[model samples]
Target: MKKIIFFHLLNDYSGSPKVLLQVIEAVAKKGFEAELYVGGGAEGGFLSSAPCVQKRYFYKRFENKYLTLLSYSLSQLILFIKLLRYRHASAIFYVNTLLPFGAALAGRVLGIQVIYHIHETSIRPRPLKLFLRWMVERCSSENIFVSHFLAKAESFTNIESRVIYNSIPQNMVSSGANHVYPYASGNKFNVLMICSLKAYKGVNEFVRIADLLSGQQDIEFNLVLGASDSEVDDFFSSVTLPDNLTIISRCKDVIPYYQRASVLLSLSKPEEWVETFGLTILEALSFGVPCIVPPVGGPVELVSEDKEGYLIDSNRVEDIAAKLAFLHKNPEVCFRLSEAARVKSLSFSVDNFESDVIEVFNGV
Candidate 1:
């Protein structure tokens, strides 16, 4: 059966875009036809290479939040008409909750079926939450989540949502350059966190750790942070640590950073509902780098107390610093942990992601 997928935009300079691209390619390779509706992309959104995966730019640009939402609704209407011409396509796959509302509304008008996807750990807008729950209660048939943690974290009351971890293509895994170290250094260790430098991301925790280690006679702490270029300056302003701690902003490629780093550090606070699935931790492990994460949220799900890694029970600065010291102090333990990391990363393969999506569509 032909399947059409919809997305808000494809300007994927980030992790989510990459994951969506993988899913699109998976759908196309499985021989099910796919289509994408996107808004303004980043210098010609180069998200995929699937010929069967069609694309249509619904808007010239996405600016002014209110106007952008209006454009999305209009685009959905146009897409709905196009799909109405082909009633044989069994399912419509929507990428976000907001789009799903539009898809469900369109489905009702066109007598079509929809399968929605959930990716975030949580979202705000209290009324929208209520509206989404009400809509899902009436319109949704099947729903899929990126991680079980995300499904549990969402406030929307719903039936069982299948958990499908994001997978990287085995080819993308086995082939992509086996991490070449990028920085020139002496004995000082490289610490990396591949995430937007938002407050909740606990970037400050890295600062706190850096501050603790800054005066240590032996080591220089380098942090490579990949922030959005839009907020490059804002992210830069968030830094308050010493001169020894270096922060690189708006990097185009993070793979080299991950490769060069001795250990991946994720020290977000409270380990609350927001830290649902640790995609960054999985990516780090995929590169054979051991990760240190707080034990509360998604990181615990991804990184266990293996020989190479441990979860910090406290969000306190001292606890995080102690963990870092342990890893650096015992290089042998670090290498052993990395070996285990490579094994664990295998479970998040994109090939498996494709297979899972196909099975869901085929009702397996």
Candidate 2:
């Protein structure tokens, strides 16, 4: 491709946008002309600090769920119109996530190659999910899944698909290499979990585990969520947080947390939400921090059972608590897992991801 145009619905501090940012950086580094067409109101957000490139806004972000739906629908309509401007240009339309179907439709009509980077399978409203899948089969030329589990879960019969696992940003990988495990310093056992502000992500379960282990003064729980301060406060307004557990909202820099983390946890409820790929788990593992991932989905691929980490049911609060307590008491086992976790993370490097992206683009 001579040039590429990217589309994403939200530009918030989330996994999808961060992954997109890495793709853009990789493409741009190869001297390819790149431009972004994304939603507005991304000031101080993750994508707001994207590399030097022309950017256009189609819609604004909304807080309410219903308004978010209306806004995204309107954004798609606006995006369809905006994409029509590049009808004569030889640019690939790279749509991120399933929300930007209008870009795919416009690309189909414009006769431009469209590649969808599928990340999640937990889209709501069955009809919408089916409609997006149908759009992918009919409109897109190729689909790039973030994990093998996601590729299998959202298989398209006609469209060519490839599984490209997301990699940690280079900065994080370098930071992780030099990070010192806090447990070695005889610090409090810090169990860290960083994720979006979603109930299905098992925020309540993390807190419940913290409550269960509250009697252990040496263990501390840190929950870092991608949300505004007010949103975080509102989410826990009715719930009581244990003194040992600290809730950190809207964390921009998680390097410090990783440096101090004794063990990282991915407590996403499998039935409610099967994580396509847990970026936080990868990040934690890069820091030589053993992680506890859900028993299913892409996270299982990143973490090995009883090796890098355990694949446990997040819903099993007592079991998860027991595992955490075991890790705390058995420092030798935890250190072994921590070392293995770091080695496991090396395979998912950004260089490999960039090479894969180039391969996919060149093949097309």
Which candidate comes out best when scored by TM-score?
A: 2
> Model 2 — TM-score against the truth?
0.97
How many backbone overlaps does candidate 1 show? 5
lDDT (Cα, tens digit) per residue for candidate 2, span 1-364: 5688888877777899999999988887888888887776545667777674756656765667788778878888888988888889998999999889999999999999999999989888778899998999888999999999999999998788999999989999999898866663447999999999999999999999999999999999999999989999888999988999998988899988898889899988888889999999999999999999998999989998999989998989999999999999999998899889989999899999999998877886
Model 2, CA-based lDDT: 0.88
Given candidate 1, what's the lDDT at residue 357? 77
TM-score of 1: 0.80
In candidate 1, how many Å is residue 301 off? 2.0
The alpha-carbon deviation from the true structure for residue 26 of candidate 1, after best TM-score superposition, in angstroms, is: 1.0
Q: Where does candidate 2 stray beyond 4 Å?
A: 60-64, 184-186
* CA RMSD (A), model 2: 1.4
> How many clashes in each candidate?
5, 0
The estimated TM-scores of all candidates read: 0.80, 0.97
Clashing pairs in 1: 167-349, 167-350, 168-349, 168-350, 308-337
